[model samples]
Target: PIPGWTLERLHKGYGQALQETEVFYDSQTDHQRLRVFDNPRFGRVMTLDGVVQVTEADNFIYHEMLTHVPILAHGAARRVLIVGGGDGGMAREALRHASAEEVTMVEIDAGVVEFCKTYLPGISQGAFDDPRLNLVIDDGAAFMRNTQKKYDVIVIDSTDPVGPGEVLFTDSFYGHAKRALTEGGILVTQNGVPFVQGEELTNSMRAFKALFADWGCYLATVPTYAGGPMAFGWGTDGPGRAVTLAELEARAAAAGLSTEYYTPEVHKAAFALPGYVRRLM
Candidate 1:
């Protein structure tokens, strides 16, 4: 009574994400995986053109932490830009700042944006419908080089450094990103897994250091991401001082911002690293 699953365990274990979804398994290597969600529940999940981008329904955890942390850290943000999040989840979070004057969402895929707007509305939640947003369906790299306007915060919601999104992980991109920010402006991006992409992590951090005088990589635990953990690198022209739990709480309260995951306690603790991770630098 199963569809194309000759192996019952594959169907049973990954069954939740594969429901009403197509699972494309790799024949050659242990790395290839993709699941396309066709039904109208959480949203459609599309992997990379080569590798699987999202394998589970719970990928939102990684998305959420990546987009919001840098914004909140800036205290009061007035303008924002999100490069390559066609799904609109990052846009939704970026708009949470009441002080945010305008948000420009530049996504490369019209198909992904349309699909997410139609089916994956839960994660994005009608963000495309917001008046504060200006949607541009185009390549993020080209947009970065061309735009003269600066922003208070920029969130790079790109996939891994694969294929079309590869240029996003380069020093050239970081150079443009530094120019795109205003004085004391900050930029944050999905830095990939600490376990699998450690050298990548170091290079990213070093790149940020070259671009901005004050820059660092911070982490959060998102189970569905990579190995139940994920990291995001932040680039800033300002100082990187430690902000305490109570201090963040007071600021959020004073600013009257509503938050579910990022609190002062969580924010302070998210930067905590183990011994091996400590040795990564």
Candidate 2:
């Protein structure tokens, strides 16, 4: 209603007011629209294609669940692959494991990486500067299809399945991801919130069921992602990948990892889906 004020709303097939900011940076990259704006309560926020990807206030919840669950469960994943996390927050958590020898992050957009590194340094904390990280600018699907390297963990940190991100949610992409991992390796993906985006979880779970021996979905709540708790798709052929609380506690101590939102107890609890979500999968 003001003459000079501008509003930015997140359009998740439905519009919701996210923030209104006067001081912000916006970019039109070759891949998508990237905006970083300051929010009074959430601190700095990043949105891609009108969807909130991360906020300085709650990024740890998303990045931690995305990284730790697979890495910690695998017990000794030295080689890791990250698909589409251009902001580098996932890589930062993966690198915390001293066992991680190499982490290859394949992001389609170099601009997203450059911009996030410059503006969201607090989130990634210079993860791009780490020697163990191999940053590749390429399509995630193409990289998965072409690479001969096998990783102990492969994480799909993609945006929603639209535009350039659509290819990543295909069955073909999941097949390639399964092939790119070593035996006992695990693959995890961002599957959106089942409360608002149930079809996304169903589609991903269907693909995983056909490809992996043991596949399931887990949960984490990121306030910025709204609607409900966010789901992460889990697929693996590894025996005993779903560890008990005692097993997780032992590994957590061994890894000596410190986290804000993820604990061994929480990790075990995340897989306990609600009744409706259980039916969805």
Candidate 3:
């Protein structure tokens, strides 16, 4: 907030962002505008290109759901790849899986990595310093296309499909991502909230359909994001990627993952999308 001015997200046609807040830091990186603020309900909030990326209070819901759903379902994901999650939340969660021996994260902008590490350290939980993480400062789309290294699980923790993040949502990127994965590997992406951006989920599923034999999406309620439930795009060549609750619970227990938002039950329930969201598929 400056003088009488306030930053707000129109959220497509959903209406105004409801949080009343105070700006802590705001600047324009080489790629997009970044803003860090404090919301009374959500605590610390990070926004890029005028979109809320994460809030300290509700971030676990988004991070855990996006990371664990695929990792746990795959049950033997050792090598993981994360694209665009410069904040490090995805890496933090992925490392919690005992099966993960190495995690390679490719982020285009070094500024986002440093900014979040300095200002939003809680979000990453020092995952940047973990010996197992390989942090690369390079374009994510290009890295996926060129890397000879394959991953057992790949998570695309990208911002909304705008500004620098738009390329990640394209079919070409999805194709390259599929090639970057090992056999039976799983890929998950942050498709926007279907309540407001139904087309985002629809388009992502369309791309997944062209690339993977089996693909679907799941939902998680992140209070930081307005409109409604956020959809996470899922894709895999493995037809048996979706396992029963009993199988997931056993895998999670074996992994010794202690999480607030993601449990075996929640993992099973997250895929039970509402009718309106299912229509997008």
Among the numbered candidates, top lDDT falls to 2
Clashes, model 3? 0
Q: Model 1, range 156-251, lDDT digits (tens) per residue?
A: 888777657778889988889889998878888887777766776787887887887777767876543435366787888764335555666767
lDDT ranking of the models: 2, 3, 1
Question: Where's the lowest-lDDT run of ten residues in candidate 3?
Answer: 1-10
**lDDT at 117 for candidate 1?**
62
Best by TM-score: 2
Better of 1 and 2 by TM-score: 2
Clashes of each: 1, 0, 0
User: How do all models score by TM-score?
Assistant: 0.82, 0.95, 0.94
- Report the lDDT tens digits of candidate 2 across residue range 1-281: 34433343433475445545644678799999998888777888888987888888999999999889998898889999999999999999999998999999999999999999988898888789999999999999999999999999999999988778999999999999999989999999999888888988899999999999999999998988877899999999996356888988888888899899999999989988999898888
Residue 46 shift from truth in candidate 2, angstroms: 0.5
TM-score of 1: 0.82
C-alpha lDDT (0 to 100) for residue 149 of candidate 3: 90
RMSD of each: 5.6, 1.8, 1.8
